[model samples]
Target: MPAKAGAVTMQQVAECAGVSMMTVSRVLNDDARVRESTRIKVMRAVAALGYRPNISARSLAGARSYLLGLLYANPSAAYISELLIGALKSCRAAGYHLVVESCDMEEAAIGEQMLALAKESRLDGLILPPPLCESAPLMAALEAARIPYVRIAPFTRLDAAPYVCIDDAAAARDITARLIALGHRRIGFIKGHPNQGASRLRLQGFQDAMQAAGLRSARRDICQGYFSYKSGLRCAEKLLNRADRPTAIFASNDDMAAAVYAVAHRHGLDIPQDLSVVGFDDTLIATTLWPPLTTVRQPIAAIAGAAVELLTTNRRAAAVLRQPAAPRRLLDYAIVERQSTAPPTTPD
Candidate 1:
């Protein structure tokens, strides 16, 4: 229907439905006071007329912009893509429009930029994805503007906002333990960006698994990665170039794992033959890479959908907006075994 029926009006819809204009307004705002039968009738008329509400007029009438903001600065393109997919789907279903803004977390003026964006958009609510979700300044700015927001995968200040996430530490532990069970002792570890809370938790999970298996040593192989393709390339190069290179590598995310595959290929090392590799975030790179990737599946899209639901379904009371019920929703995670990993080949 032209993607949007911006030309249709509520007056036309009301006329078609044989209802009062006020009744149409009530149905549009989702007021429970409206009878369910009446709502259905109005919806039928709306569909028949291809009616679309004028968001600006609706705002002036009911003090609701009906626009939700999605702000993200995550390093993984695959992760961001997933977030967008889930959020956009939810927003459309809720009769709300989605506005996306990409901000650079590295920028010093993040708070000012975010505030400016909010002021410009007059958003009804916001959905924040990781790293951005933990930014104290940005959160404060949102509070100053009094905009309700939901966080996706925020680790710190769990009570500060409504959020959705899985047990990162446990997920990491499971994957690491799986590698240990595969008979790999000298497994390389590549960490994600320091800005993200999941990075630390995943690392701890890895360490905990190693300690439990008696694989911990005074010396170990680990590298820092920023969860970016470039950072993954850099970290993989450093880890692979070492003389006492690890028999296996576990990157914090799939992008880095893909990078390991590239680096191993350049060094003439065969997969699982010379080095076994694994990664987290079962993102697109997991299946696209050669031999695929054994990784942890984090439900990036479902988390995003949950965040949008929290933002839309909540009542507008000041207290309700300030403190959402069911503040933190923990979802499920799984270890997806692909072809990227195997037992370390017997030393020649």
Candidate 2:
């Protein structure tokens, strides 16, 4: 124990415990197949020796690669950027390296591309973000290859794999209700990309809130969007061009909400006074508008970090032990208020 800690090796631990290196490996992996007495002895020796295994050394001592992989094909740059920040921090802390790959969604078979990425990189595990997380082909490929992965926010198959996510529908409902509470009856909503599962939940949240308020969300008030700035611009134009425009708009994310701000300006509409706007994913874009936006915070970075930790630590094994279904970690969401939303003004 007085040793530098770094110099201790698995062999030293095994010898001190009077057991074979294989026994020590089984204990560390929590294989469950190892004898209780042997496992206890190996653990004590490991503690007494202060032996810390390097990534490569740890991999050699067990069946793990000690290398984690993350793949994403997200249209929202802000979300992906936050995801990387969190994932990288956790990987560094866990003494593991992250291999981030961007799969070509346009490829004929996304599953094949994922398979290539896994084999080419020798991934021990994977962390998948939106779009990629919901890819059936990718998930099937990983399962067939026996590579364990954790998803961020999957639309379906809640039991398919370990994951980290916020309650998208609940958060959306809260944000939408916030708009309604402000006495705005005609609130427009911009939907995100249909491909991303969270988008649907957010839209449902909006609809649920509107229905609860005894307000009918006219079809004209709901516009289609793709979670992109350009898409927001077009959708906003279509929704705001009419003389009977809504008094408020709730965008699925801050990026599109910012686009709504731009359209309001061109149309000579005054924020809060003439229009109220809200958004989701309390990313930085939420604050850049003239009157900062009120949005739902998704904790993108925290979700990413948790996903990495789950894969690198024993949590992944615990989840596997929960057989027939994967373990899921649900994080909290918050509604942030700013200058962008207020009670609608009365007409002269």
State the lDDT of candidate 2 residue by residue for 1-348, as single tens digits.
345657888899899999998877767666867887987798788778776667787777666676788888878889889999999998876667899888766666998888887887788788988878888888788888877788888888566578889999999999888888888898899999888889999988999999999989889998989899999999899989988888999999899999999999999998978999999999988877789889999899999999987776544244332346666789999999899888888631
Task: Put down candidate 1 lDDT per residue, 1-348, tens digits, no spaces.
Answer: 422476777788888899999999888887768888998999898877677676667788886788889988887899999889988888876678899999999898898898888778888888888899889888888888788888777668556577889999999999989988988888888989898989989988999999999877223477889998788888889888989788888899988888899999999999978899999888887898889888999988888888888887664334224664446678999999988788888741
Query: What is the alpha-carbon lDDT for the whole of candidate 2?
Result: 0.84
In model 2, where is the ten-residue run with the lowest total lDDT?
A: 314-323
- TM-score, candidate 1, is 0.85
lDDT of 2 at 189: 92
TM-score of each: 0.85, 0.85
Cα RMSD (angstroms) for every candidate in the order listed: 3.7, 3.9
Model 2 lDDT, residue 163, Cα: 83
